[model samples]
Target: MELVTDQHKKKAKTILKWLITAGIGCLFLFLFFILSLWGFAKIQGPPPIKVPQTTRIYDANHYLIGKVEHENQNRTWVHMDDISKSLVNATLSIEDKRFYQHHGFDLKRLAGAVLADVKSFSKQQGASTITMQYARNLYLDHEKTWMRKLTEALYTMRLEMNYSKDQILEGYLNTIYYGHGAYGIEAAAKYYFNKNADELTLSEASLLAGIPKGPSYYSPYHNFKRAKQRQKIVLQSMVNNGYITKQAANSAFHAPIRLVHKHKPMNRTAPYFQDAVESVLQNQLHIDQKTLAAGGLKVYTTLNSNMQKKAEYWVKQVINPASDIQTAVIAMNPQNGAVEAMVGGRDYHKSSYNRAVQAMRSPGSSFKPFLYYAALRNGFTPSTTLRSEPTTFTYNKGKSKYAPSNFGGYYANGPITLAQALALSDNIYAVKAHLSIGMDQLVKTARKVGIKAPLADIPSLALGSQPVSVLEMAKGYSAFANGGARVTPHYITKIVNQKGETIYEWHPKKEQVLNKAATFVLSQLMTGVFDKKLNGYSKVTGASIAHILTHKVAGKSGSTAADSWMIGFTPRLVSAVWVGYDKGQSISTYPDSGYAKKIWAHFTESALEGQPKNSFKPPKGVVRRLVDPKNGKLAAKGCPNARYTYYLKGTAPNEYSHRCYKEKGPENGRKKHKGFFNRWFHWFH
Candidate 1:
């Protein structure tokens, strides 16, 4: 028995020796791995701690309009002293009770989390310490891989070695997202309560502290009830962790928290206009999205606050909100292309699709001015007559037949002057002119006047069958208003860096596109649209505007089955209004409702109230001649349709009217009319 016992003891000793050797080897391997990881982390260095600053946008009057954060991370860094103590306590109590006691991690909490995850067969709990969270947010991407976890551990150790406890807490608080596009305690306080972080009360702080765990799930703006319930949990954690007394926690639980009901004021006064300006900046500066968001730019736009307000007010008053009709308005200086006001849609909060700049719809008869301008370039005068009758245009060598008719099949069936036809929006006359001058000339004319949409070389181009944006229409009409100068529409007048250094400034480019005489003639012809007697038609397309304001104005009205448009301009300002449904549904079957015209009149009347009234200045080459409207000839005193019309030099009528002479008896015979230039010059003097 003694010999057996000795053998057993020897076997046990051998097993013990092997076990100790294995354990030592394992320990050495573990130490080596840790040392290697630490060395690698040291070589990698700490992650960048820079937080993106806010970019502010200002209007023409230097009033704050809006703000954008870097990469949508709306964070504002705050020091430890600037943050409320309650927030720190609540955050630490719920997130990591042993935050200050641990070097970089809490092993006890980590063990519990691992066990729980194993039991659930999924990672349902996170035991990351505040320092770990800060390390991951600053240094590592949010990945749940084992390699990522190891890297995070190394980064956490480095963070703990470098930063103090308070600094780690401040960094964590500032880097964490708190929903509603808010990152950091400062942004959370402002977004949720419209107050500063230091001004947050206990209830507000607790609520904000609970959001970092699951920002979207516990967002007060999305689910207030869930947020409050989470707040109760955070308060209980604070009590259990001894950060606050039970009584204090209870008081906070019952404290009434007044959350901001309305959307946090982002200072966005003209969201649509700001969007346009941002797009320009992106293209002009060749900036990426990240640079634009956090670049700390001070964008000075051409938005007039008063004009924008007037536009919004008029839109709300004229259109019913419940109708779900989309409307867009753009007002700009015709001389410089400085956008004064812009309304992209009816409700920007509901839908941010800017119809003014993005939506491409048919301009309908509003496109006729470009067609007429082409005709004028081809030797067609305002007094030149065309037969306003049903016409069939052949395309593809008669494979396609397009018969164009007037609106409601109402045609004069006889010759009509170009001015009267344009004022009346005669489809047949426009189509005839389009065929006479060819489609390329009309397309070129539209392009010169700032129509950027793709226009087909079809005959329907004359009747506005091509789609274009309201902004383009406004810009195109501005040529006539500015005496044939092509102005590029722009919103941002200047852009400055954060340090108030001018980085970019807008210089208006005035390109002369047409002769001043042609532009003036067109402008004068458009005035007849507002004068029913001058148009000599039963329905003047834009006559409604004449009753609203006494100022001299010229505009055109356009409509399709699904869209309605009214674009007008004075010498100083050009504005356009479009009303339609997003789904391409017709507004009303009746053409005379004139909803678009009424909205335009209301907005323009208010917008142009204090502005000076100016008229188009005729260039030196333009000559005024009194001619018979029936024929392009000199009129006698008794001529019925005699009116003073403008013509380019050398384009005036050279022959006297024989019919008018017959009506005025032999006293005004051809012999008496000899040397007609001398006689007319004497009468004019």
Candidate 2:
């Protein structure tokens, strides 16, 4: 028995010796592998550190309109000096008590976390130091796997070796995600307290420190009671870490915290406009999405806040909220083509479709001015008479016949002058003119004045049968208001980079596309829509809203089955208003038919409130003469209805009205009826 026991002991001792040798060898191999990784990390610096930031937008007056962010990551980086001490201390206490003492990994906390995770049979415990967390945030995905952990461990060592303690902490604070679309401490401060990071109080700091643990659950905006409980735990941790006294910790926990009002969280005052500006930045400017998100570029737009407010107000006041009718309003500067105000739809939250730039609807009779401009350029005068009776004409070499009637099926049934036809929005006269000038000339004329939408060379084009956007109409009308200088509609006027250098600037694109003298005569004739004396068989299209005019304005009104448009302009500003259903439903003729005119009147009056009532200045060689609109003949004292009519130099008729009597004047009173330009232009010279 003694011999057997000795043999067993010898075998056990031999096995123990071999096991010890193998264990020592494995430990040495592991150490060598770690050292090799450390050496490799030294040669490879950190990956590019690009933190997402917020791009702020401002109006023409430099007032903040809203902010733009990428993927809801709203972050604004700040220096360590800008952060409050309380926030830093509270964060450190709850997150890592030995943040400064440890290099990268804390063995004591790791051991405890491992033991707890083993006992609970789960991998829910975390022992990441600030440096380790920072590395994970910057470089690695947050997937709890063995491979990811090993990668994270390698990155942690690299961060500790390359950066100082303060650098690591600053990066951690800026890159961490908070609740409610806020990605950094500064953004959290602004979103929660409506204040800056340096202005946070002790209670506010504690409240914010508790959010990073579970942003959605501990958000005060989500659950106040849970947020308060988390704040108390943070305060207790601060006291235990010796960063704050017990008395101060208790006081902060019991103090009342005020959060920002839960209203307008997105700050989207003009969401549609913001979207249009972003599209221009991406598509037109060729700016990539990634650069736009983090480039910190400042976009200065031409939006007038006062005008925008008025546009929105009038739209709401005029259109009933319960109705499904959608409306779009666009106002621009006639001289520069700056888009002063824009409303895409009735409500932005309900729908984001921008009708001003998107919806393509017919402009109705408001498109007559473009046709008339084409006529004037082709040697057609305002006194040119056309038969207004309903008639069918054969075109396409006798292959097509088109017959159009005036509104309400009422026409003069006789020859009518162009001025009276335009004032009444006569369809037959426009069709006659469209066919007389050849269908292609109107298309060329429309394109020359900035109408970008495709127009068909057909007789129906004369009555505004082609669909176009409100913005296009506004842009086309700006030419007439600015004496035929075509302008391009644009939102952004300048863009500045983070280095305070201007990268883009806009200069007015004023191309002279129409004859100045002809345009001046056309503008004067357009105002006949409001003149009652020119009314013959039909009321002027603008007669319903003429009493609301506080300034000298010239414009046209148009409508189709599904659309109603009132587009007009002054010397300084031009606006186009449209009301219709999205599904192309026929609008009622009574109240729904009148919404566009009312909105236009109110918005135009409000937008031009503080400005002067400036009149359109006629370019040289344009002349005005008093003549009867009924017959387009030279006016005499015996004429029943006489008014001042504008015409190109030498285009005025020399023959007197038949109602005239023999007068004691020079050359049968022909010299007494000279054009206004004959006196005004020569006198100035």
Candidate 3:
């Protein structure tokens, strides 16, 4: 019996030893599997937690104008400390009760969830920890495929190995979509409760905590009863997790909750200005729309709010709301090329096509400034005379006979000074000057002055027949306003990242492109459009709105069959306005024809109201001479139509007009010409 007992003890010892050895081997295999997963996750790099932040836009005064709306990522990141404590507690209690205790996965809950899913013969029961869900949101798509799940698991492991529990929690709260185009807790709080995340009450916290499970299914905006039921479940979970007492949970569940009205947020102020800024960002800065939307950059624009408001106001006040006639206005600072105000269309909501920068219409006489400036560069003073008559010009080696008639067929019938031609917008005089200077030279000069639109080297171009945008016209005229320094139009002045680092800042450099004397001479000649004294066969083109000028303004008015344009500038500001139909329909209505001038006059006056009345100062190389408008000669005593005309220092007329003195002979060795056309045309050839 003793021998049998000893043998039994030895057999039991052997069995026990084998059992311990097998258990140890199984434990080692499990550790090896976990280490393999950890290695793979490490090789996959850190988890993606970069959240798309909201990009803000400001005016020149640093006042918030609006925020750029990226797809559905209406998120504003806040620190964990800025979130309500109750929200954190409620979220953790409902989302992952063992979030603090586990590294990334909770085995017990995962086992229970697997068993339940197996019993139900489906994968409906979820065992995702907050870290796992965050990984899924950040890295993988929400497809229920096993590959996505496995990828999510790897990312979850990566996040746990790299970031702290607090970091994971904060990122999770900030990135989760909460429906209604709201991403993150802060935007959700604002959309649902009309309050900030830090200001949420216990009831609000529990209510928001229940939304992430199925945002659309449990949204209070979609189904309040279901959302309340889910909120009750979240409150009970908090109670069970010891985050709140049962009595406290009950009180929170019954607390009165106020929800904001369900509507799309209307926080944007200047829609057209915002669109223009985006255009500059894409076209000039080379920042694509997708990156700009998600970059979280704070853009500071050169927009003056007061000027923008006045521009819009005048546009609305001028054009009838019932008509289809559209108007575009642009007010820019000529000193720096900063676009202070922009009105793209009469109504932006109806049509977003920006006429200010997009629509290319015939500039008519508005383009004559560039033509006359080119003439000035080619040794033509403001007092230079051209025969303004109805004449057919033989061009293309007599193959093309171009006949450009004056407006209403009213011409000087003899000769008119360059200033009077500009004031009356004489087509014949413009064509002669354009042909005399060589057509291609005018195109080059226009481009040099910042006119980027394609120009045709034709005789009609002299009469402002080329199609150009209002913005290009404004930029072209900026050189004249700023004393010959060319400037590029700029909207955004600075761009800063979310980290308060400046990514871009505009330091405008003035490239001197035009002759200072020529630009000044042309600028002063432009003022003749308002002077009734320069009116010859017809009144000055700007005569109708001349009474509205409160200060010195040099500008021109242009009219085509389909388009009407008024471009002018003071020393500080240049405004270009265009009024026409979207489809090229001739402006037949009297009111429609006058819209450009009215809008320009009102907006310019209002914009310069509180500012100094600055006058255009002539450059050093320019000389002022009192000259006769009828003939390109120096004024003598008792001259009928003598006015101060600007000229390049050496180009002022030395020969006194025969009308001044009854004698027509050589004076001071200056021989008198036989005929005006014979001598002037001879010199031109």
Candidate 4:
């Protein structure tokens, strides 16, 4: 009996020793895990929370015109005060019932979730509080792994320690994705209900609050029935949490939630202009696309909505939708170079290629004015005679030859005054003038007036063989209208940051690049292109349409086999229009009275409707003289054909004709010239 009791006592002692060892090992393991968790929490501070914002663009009147959104992340941050109380209550009830009581995680919910998962034999339950979800959203990936969860927990603790409860809620609401390209509560509200967050009703709030759980599964836009089911669950949760009465929950669940039936895609106003502005900002400010997409910029442009509408209307009216032809128009304040209106194409939705600034097409005879301006600066008068007969020339040491002819092969074939040559758009005369003035001088003149296209020294450049954009042409013509002052075309007038601080403002730089007197003389000569009756010639050029309006204007018309252009200006506005196929096909089937001139005339007339009509004021150092149209010489009173011609002060005709000054008898009918010089001049007369 003694031996059996001793053995029992020994067995009991061994069992107690084994139990103590197991407890010590378990305690050591717990201590090590706690230490490691503390170290990790200390090391990992917080996660980066990116609240993607949309960049907005406004017109001159400060109306929202367009928005640039980040890929799949359209967010608009709203204050907690602006958020609906119903949405907040619903979110708290569904996501975390004991959010206010917990520090970073709910210990009771965690234990319950663990027990439930163990019972189910799978990780099927989540115990994440609002703070923990926010931490995971901002800092850690949503991976079902131990390391990710540990990091998420550490971030949650840091978030709870640093931010208040309201801040945490705001962050979670703003960072959560509600599907359909919406990344914030404000965006989601706008996307689903077409209203702001503060304006959401109880039904709408519950529906939106339930979306974040499984955006794809609960999106009202995608699956209305599923979304309604989830919304009912949220309403029940709100009722169970005592946030709302059972009666209110029942009313919400039974209420007809009017989900927006047709989701209206964001409509872009003046998309081409917006594209040009974006390109300008990117290039001039050295702004990256990423930075631009993460927007907070307030760009003020020079677009006149009224004028833009007019331009767009005229573009549609002139071009048939079935035709392959495309058109571009640009209008500007000639005095300041502000681009008031621009239409890059007929439909910006089909294509975004900005024809006004990007397309480089030949200007045709529209380029003649630049050559004439150069000639005028080189001591050539409007009355200076040039042989307009068809001609040819050899260049490049006789390796190349050019023989340009007049349109329709209709040549004057005689001495024609500079004014008549320009009015008729004589190709031979233009090439002759370009050659006489030197190609280098012509290119320099073109450059001074804002033609940025590369122009070769070839003679065809006089006829606009080189490709130039409509914007460049507008700027070049603006120099003529602005009295020879070169203008740099620009759209953005000012830019403000999100903080309401001015970050950029435009200060125009005007340079007087052409002689004022010469420009006036050149402009006066171009006016003859629009004259109803020039001595014996009838109005036949593109400027003939300008004669319909009472406003005084000067312009030129140009056409190639494939392109047509009209660039004109008044004292206030300068506009340019181009029409052609996108692939540079022949538009020769269309007449000179085609889309280009018609659109230009209609748009210019509409743009200048309410504005004052101002005439071009001639500068000093210009002289007017009466010359015989037949001979381009000083006119006598008895001369049958005579008109006033413009010339620089010292460049007018120095010789007078006495052949027509003599009185004639009725029998003789006309006076006869006896002198050799008079007879010689009589041949041309």
User: Candidate 1 has what TM-score?
Assistant: 0.66
> Distance (Å) between predicted and true CA of 101, model 1?
24
Instruction: Compose the digit string of candidate 1's lDDT tens values, residues 1-685.
Output: 9999999999999999999999999999999997886677667666567455567888899998887543335567899999999998899999888998998889998999889988988765778999988887666556566688878898887777667899899999987878656778998898788899999888889999999888768987767899999999999999898888889888998988888766633446777888787777766666544345555778888999999999988888887666778889999999999999999998776776899999999989999988888898898988788887787878767788889878878887788888789888999889888888887999999889878789998888888888899999999999999999999988888888767899889999999998788888888777768766544534678766688867778788888888999988889889899988888887674532366788888888888897776556678788888776555577755566566678877777777777666666656444454586867866766
Candidate 4: stretches off by over 4 Å: 1-53, 69-266, 535-539, 591-593, 612-614, 627-630, 634-644, 654-685
Using lDDT as the yardstick, the better of models 1 and 4 is: 1
Q: Against the hidden true structure, what lDDT does model 1 obtain? A: 0.82
Residue 222 lDDT in candidate 3:
72
**Which runs of model 2 end up more than 4 angstroms from their true locations?**
1-51, 70-265, 637-640, 659-685
Candidate 2 at residue 491, lDDT?
96
Residues 283-390 of candidate 3 have per-residue lDDT tens digits of 687764434555678999999998999999988888888999998999999999999999999766566688998899999988888888888888788777778888
Between which residue pairs do clashes occur in model 4?
Answer: none
Model 4 scores what on Cα lDDT?
0.81
Model 1 CA deviation exceeding 4 Å by range:
1-53, 69-181, 184-267, 283-295, 589-593, 627-642, 655-685
Compute the lDDT of residue 307 as modeled in candidate 1: 94
Write model 2 residue lDDT over 1-685, tens digit each, in one string: 9999999999999999999999999999999997888877766766566554467789999998976654356468888899999999999999998989988888899999889988988777889888888877776656667688888888888887788888888988987777756778998998889888889988999999999888768989778999999999999999998989999988998888888765353557677888889879877998654446556789999999989999999999988777899999999998999998999999876676899999999999989899999999887888889989988978999999988877789989999999988898999999999999899998998899888898998899999999999999999999999898999999999999878999999998799998899988998898888888798987888899888887778888998888899988888999999999998999975778889999998899888897777677878987888887777888864455578889999788776675433433444344543688666766766
Give the TM-scores of the predictions, in the order they appear: 0.66, 0.66, 0.66, 0.63
**lDDT (Cα, 0-100) at 240 in candidate 2:** 92
Select the stronger candidate by TM-score from 3 and 4: 3
